[model samples]
Structures are given as C-alpha cells and as structure tokens.
Target: MKIIRSKSFTGERAWAALDIANMNGITTRLHWTDQPYKWHTNDGEEVFVVLDGQVQMRYRDLGVEREVLLEVGDIFYASVGTEHVAHPVGAARILVVESEGSV
Candidate 1:
C-alpha cells in the first residue's frame, strides 16, 4: 500500500499512479481542475472515484447525450469505447482505476 499526498503535485492538477491490485490492475489519481477534456479507449473499462469537489460527466453516443453529476465520495464507471468528458464544477479530485491493457 502507498499514500499519495496532494502537495506532491506541481500544478493545479496532480496525479499519482498506484498499483494496488495485481490481477485487476491499479489506479490513477487526477486532481481537480477547470479544464474540460475527453477520454476514450478501446482497451478496458475505467472506474472513477470522486474524492473531493464536484464534477460533471458527459457521455455522447450517436447524437445522444447524457450527463451526470458526481460529488465527493461518489463513484462512476465508464466502459471502453465510450466517448466521454469530465469537467470540474468547482475544484475536484478523482481516483481512476483501470484494467491494465493497451489504450
């Protein structure tokens, strides 16, 4: 087990890649920021845990759009091949756990 502190980050967005599991894989920590960005992959699913602040997750598919709000202690999952983006409503922190595979 390991502990990642928030102060280790150089910018507004801090990150730490942790190998907590051997079979399923590990996790990544994403510090909150105002930037809106999209993430997609053909590899595997991604699990997100909201540690602090608020975030809006948007999913788009075949002209259809869906949005969800995530607060602290909330968890969300996104399957592979799903085009999505997440933006911080204020300042937020999220823990992302993904299966080890090609992206």
Candidate 2:
C-alpha cells in the first residue's frame, strides 16, 4: 500500500506523473504541472480530476475550439477521439485515469 500526498508531488519536468494503479487494464496517475500540455486525442476514454489549484481545459467539439475552467474537485471526462489539452492556472495536481498505454 502506498500513501501519496498529491499536493506535495512534483515532477522533474513538465506534467510530471506518478503511477498510481493499473486495474483490469485501466491505469491511474497523479500528475503535477505548471505548463500547458499539447493538444492530442486519447485512444480511449479519459477521466481528468483536478486535485489542487486550477486548470483551463481546451478541447475541440464538432471542430469548434472550446475551453473550460477546471477548479479543485472538478472532473473532466474525455471520450475517445476527443481532442484536448490542459493549461494549468499555476502549479496544479491532477489525477488522471485512462486505459493502459493510451495517449
């Protein structure tokens, strides 16, 4: 068993991630970032949870670019083929759940 303190975690690089679990082919991770992530599409479904600070989530819906502010405790679900990016307001901790090896 591991007890992780998400707020205190930091990555040596942008969007540092700590592996949390992989159950039944699903993976979970805790990420620390202060920079914006590149736009990309997940090969499978994704669940993004903000644990600390805030984030500006950008996505394309029906070819229209859109954004939303994700605050602490906010959860964003990205279905397969959803193109999205995450821009943290500052230093932020996030929990992400997706299929193993998904981008």
Candidate 3:
C-alpha cells in the first residue's frame, strides 16, 4: 500500500500534482499550489477538496461572478461546463477528483 503524509508533501513548483489513482476515466490527485489558476470550464464534473491552508474558489453563475473561501476539509463540487478558478491563499494542498485530461 502506498502511504502519503500530506503535511510533508511539497511540490517543486506551484500547481504541481501527485497522481493518486485513476478509475475508469476519472483521476484523483493531490495538488500543491501557491498561485492562482486560469478560469476555464471542465469537460466533466470536478470535486475539489481543501486538505490544508485556504483557497478562494471563484465561479460564474448566470454571467455573474461569485467566490467563496474554502478552508481545511471544505469541498467544492463543480458541474460540467461550470466556469471557475482557484486561488490559493499563501500556500495550499488540495485533493481533486475529476475526469482524466479535463481542463
């Protein structure tokens, strides 16, 4: 069995991710980032979980922009074609489950 200690996990650069698992066409990854990501909609649904630190999740709803602060243990679910972006507060480690090759 593979064991990962999240508190000790660090990436070489921002948004670096460690592959955890892949089932069917879906993937689970552990991501480390200190920067914000670009706004884009996914090809499939996405499940985002905050493992450590804070993240500001921004999304567009009916052409209006909205944001929420996600702390540890917080989960954000995004449906397909939902335009969104993630901005880490300082540094953050997040768990993401989504379709493989989704952008």
Candidate 4:
C-alpha cells in the first residue's frame, strides 16, 4: 500500500503511473494543470476516481462525450480498447486503477 500526494506532480499535466503488477495490474493518477490529456489502453480495465475539480472524458468509439464534474469522492470506469481523453476544466486530480485478467 503506497500513498501519493497530489502536489507531487505539479509540473506536468499527465498520468503518473504509481504501481504496476504484471500478474495483477497497474494503478495510476492523472494530475492535470489547465490542459487536456489523453489516456488509452489496448487490453485492460481501468477505474477512474476524481479527487478534485472537474474533468470531461471524451470517448472515441461511440463518438460521445461526458462531462464529469467530480468532487473528492467521485469515481468512474472504462473498459478495454476504449480510446478516451480528458480535459481539465480547472486544476483537477484523477486516480486510475487498472487491472488485467478476468474480472
């Protein structure tokens, strides 16, 4: 169990991969500035948790977009092969939990 602070990734508006497990999966967080960022996976599942501010997730497959105004305890999930991008409305933090194998 590892803990990461939000202030650690202050310079970049990108995904900070925290923990990785080949047998299990990976856990990461996207700390955004006032810019947009994209995250995609080939074959895995991911769980997104909003830590602060607002973020909008744009999906490429369905050609749909979702604006998630996340507080401290908000969470979302994304499936495999889903091309998704996120833009911060303001300064925001998002936690991503990814796992491999059968769910």
Candidate number of the best lDDT: 2
Can you write out model 1's per-residue Cα lDDT over 1-103, one digit (the tens) per residue?
Answer: 6566643433444332433444546445455455665565536778888777788988877768888999888887877777777887856666677766534
Q: What TM-score does candidate 2 get on C-alpha atoms? A: 0.97
lDDT of 4 by residue, 1-103 (tens): 5556754645443543444334435645444456777555546777877777677766666766545555667776777777777777777766666664422
TM-score of each: 0.69, 0.97, 0.97, 0.63
The best candidate by TM-score is 3
lDDT of all predictions: 0.65, 0.96, 0.95, 0.61
Worst 10 residues of 2 by lDDT: 7-16
**Candidate 2 per-residue C-alpha lDDT over 1-103 given as tens digits, one digit per residue, 9 for 90 to 100:** 9999987899998888999999999999999999999999999999999999999999999999999999999999999999999999989999999999988
RMSD of each: 3.5, 0.7, 0.6, 4.4
TM-score of 3: 0.97
Question: Candidate 1 has which clashing residue pairs, if any?
Answer: none
Which residue pairs overlap in candidate 3's backbone? none
| Order of candidate numbers by TM-score, starting with the best | 3, 2, 1, 4
The residue-level lDDT of candidate 2 at 43 comes to 94
Error of 4 at 11 (Å): 3.5
- Comparing 1 with 4 on TM-score, the higher-scoring candidate is 1
TM-score of 4: 0.63
